[model samples]
Target: MGRWVLHLPVALPRRVDAVVLVVALRDSLGHVPALDFGEATVSAEDDQSRRTRVWCDARLGGGQRCELPLAHDGGCR
Candidate 1:
């Protein structure tokens, strides 16, 4: 399939709330092979193009990537 973005609007007024929702959604949908949780991000409603990644997403090796939080300390998973 080609690349595409799915925008799900959250009416919550806080960034933390929105981030939590997205993380929850990712966990629930983790079973889908087509979904790349590492690529997950959140952006302000006024600027959807400017994204803040939720995960470190650093390339580890052999088609694998770091699954830790973006600002996580210690080694990447």
Candidate 2:
């Protein structure tokens, strides 16, 4: 298994907008690999330190749905 990082940038709340997360993967051939998108959760804390945590429990394979958290580092409850 390889390591991948997902980055999200959004304006501080109290502003009306939508967060967009694009999930993509590349193969060994340096091409967009067929992703087997599975069930996952992205969470952030409600307290001061908005540390985001992501949890993935499903088998992945080419493309997947983006599950964004409502807060940062609240421990994926």
Candidate 3:
């Protein structure tokens, strides 16, 4: 199955900062089983090329998603 996309309007001007904020929010709300933090990504308006992934989001055993950063070295958790 494919993943869903959500566009959130943030007040920050920089993409890096926006990603940081997003990761922080996801981590703080980690207890929420409904939130898929691994699939989180940030992008400029209407720019698919600039779409930056905030997490690895790789599928693991036991139906779990990787919580590491995008393109992270080593193994997924």
Predictions: Cα RMSD each: 1.8, 9.8, 3.3
Q: Per model, state how many residue pairs clash.
A: 0, 13, 0
The reply for model 3, stretches above 4 Å from the true place, is: 1-6, 46-50
Mind giving the per-residue lDDT tens digits that candidate 1 earns over 1-77?
Answer: 88887666667787788778878977899889878888887788898899889889899999989978899999998
TM-score of each: 0.80, 0.21, 0.74
The C-alpha lDDT values of all candidates are 0.84, 0.34, 0.79
For 1-77, candidate 2 gives per-residue lDDT tens digits of 99665444444442222222323221222243433323222333244254323323222335333343344343332
Error of 1 at 59 (Å): 1.4
Q: Rank the candidates by lDDT, best first.
A: 1, 3, 2
| Deviation (Å) of 77 in candidate 1 | 0.6
Winner on lDDT between 1 and 3 is 1
For model 2 the local lDDT of residue 53 reads: 34
